[model samples]
Target: MAFLAWSVCAHPHATGLLPETRLKFRPPPNSLFAVLLRSPWWVSLLIAAVLGLVAAALLPEAFRVVGALSGFPFIVIAAIAAQRQWRLPSAARVQQTQEAVSAMAWPAFQALLTDGLRRSGIEVQPAPAGDAVDFVMERQGLRTLVSARRWKSARLGVEPLRALQAARQADNTTADVPRAVCICLGGFSDTAADYARAHGITLWQASELALAMRGVTLPAPKPAR
Candidate 1:
């Protein structure tokens, strides 16, 4: 049965009759209507309306004839304009978005930490610093400093952690040694994680940072259901 089916399918006559046809449809020369409508949504709509009216006045059947004749030409024009105008702004938008996201590192870090700690029932107040100290947590009317470091790479060495410890030690007394939390975009190195754990500093990475932000606003007490 398999051999019979293969022989029938492989037959030259059967294959010749089932020829593939690629269809190509080209619009008419007078496609101004299509062209006018091919711009940004607002621009194309405005242009199409004006052009449609002008075309109707210049043609015999007013609306119907002019619209039918206008579709192809306008489509071509709009396609060209859309390709040029729409794509031109895309590169700029991408660049602007990149700049915006890059600027967000500090804010994202602050928000992430503030949200995370607050979720953990800790109230945090952000202190002004140059890309450092996202917030200082105030519990029981006493402030405990919490710093966030948003590193680009995951492999942050002990130097940063040591420096942070030193800074915290210098800034506050031994009694007020603020627990330093390093928030890294990428995952931390094994050594970094070990150092953080040994030093008693909370090291949050990736999605954990996002969760902390969401934790800040907890649900109010529900009525007895």
Candidate 2:
């Protein structure tokens, strides 16, 4: 599991707006860990079992014990993957949740996002007037500027994200600059995603919103105006 504890380094100025941020554990694109994380938990477990059995059959008697331990890493990966996958809402639940979120008014949706972030132990504060950012979040001594006003947009382009990146840059003073996060119900365009990735902006779409609102009661949609 030590390999799972990779360090994060901020590479600001990669895109000349902000540093390239590796905010999450993004294993090498073609590595086994990446494959295991993407595949179902059961797949990892099956692979681990097969490895253990194969090692036992081929290894000498004395080395069999050591060989069997070769599958331990995969078992660990399976547990981690299972824990993450378990937290995600089911397909049906995600559809229902997204539908509910889409129907919510801006105020209600903002409140929902606030509640979700608070539940995750992040302190939320309102953004300053006349900014693209909707809220400011602080957790573990790091600040993140969150722009979620476009949550209902049909297709989020790079403009809103670029604004958020600018906001983050404006807020930066010292070495520990704030991170940027964008929330949209409608998915982002390919160029938007690429820009976010390049600038270290976290984009939360339908599936992510569903995951965040898990177990919380959504507010009823407002009556037609």
Candidate 3:
């Protein structure tokens, strides 16, 4: 009789039963645990009932109500697990997006450097070597080699300045042509700036570059007569 009663009460087609009683045999959402449990409503109910039975069993006869209370907790845990599984993939995708942005750091800096120089009305030349140099700028009919480096810990040491001087001197320009500049994204060393000043070379830091490019637009050159 108990077996027949259980089968009828748990049956999906059982008549006159409460909606929740009918749901007790339905399937859970597609989660790992649900898959393991075959997503069957009976499995979840069975688990909950078993937990309640255990809790009730562990209590004194007078407090046996505790075991019967486990069903709600079991359902809550399953619901939480399902939600977590659904959100895990979204979290992973966000992490991947962050990594991609990090990988593009160098490319972003290069573009910023090139664009800033070009937009400042400077005629920039292609670099002979790596993508380090921002661009080659010209002003007042003088050919000036230009480079931009954006870094927090960067310092303008003597070596780069020496190389720039050497390259300019070796170029075909007349002796009176001024040397080029290395624009640092940050400030420069006091000694480095002083040395550049003494040698008639320009040292443009971030602030100076900002000021120089501010409100300045270059017009197209007219054709020579």
Count of clashing residue pairs in every prediction: 15, 5, 4
Per-residue lDDT of candidate 2, residues 1-225 (tens digit): 465565445432211222233325667868888788778999989988998899899989999888888788778778767766776678977777788888878898888877876776667887865568888877656677888888889999999998888888778533676887788878899999999999889888777777666767876546688
Which 10 residues in a row give candidate 2 its minimum summed lDDT?
A: 12-21
Q: After superposition, how far is residue 31 of candidate 2 from its true place, in Å?
A: 0.2
Using TM-score as the measure, the top candidate is: 2
Winning candidate number (lDDT): 2
lDDT of candidate 3? 0.49
Quick one: RMSD of model 2?
5.5
User: Which pairs of residues collide in candidate 3?
Assistant: 26-41, 52-67, 55-67, 56-67
Query: What is candidate 1's lDDT per residue for 42-136, written digit by digit as tens?
Result: 56545556777777776667465646445444334454455435422244343433333234556564554465456555676655453345556
Better of 2 and 3 by lDDT: 2
Q: Which stretches of candidate 3 lie over 4 Å from their true place?
A: 1-106, 129-134, 150-152, 173-178, 212-225
Candidate 2 CA-lDDT value: 0.75
Q: Which pairs clash in model 2?
A: 11-19, 11-20, 12-19, 13-18, 13-19
Task: Provide TM-scores for the models.
Answer: 0.39, 0.82, 0.40
Weakest 10 consecutive residues, lDDT, candidate 3? 12-21
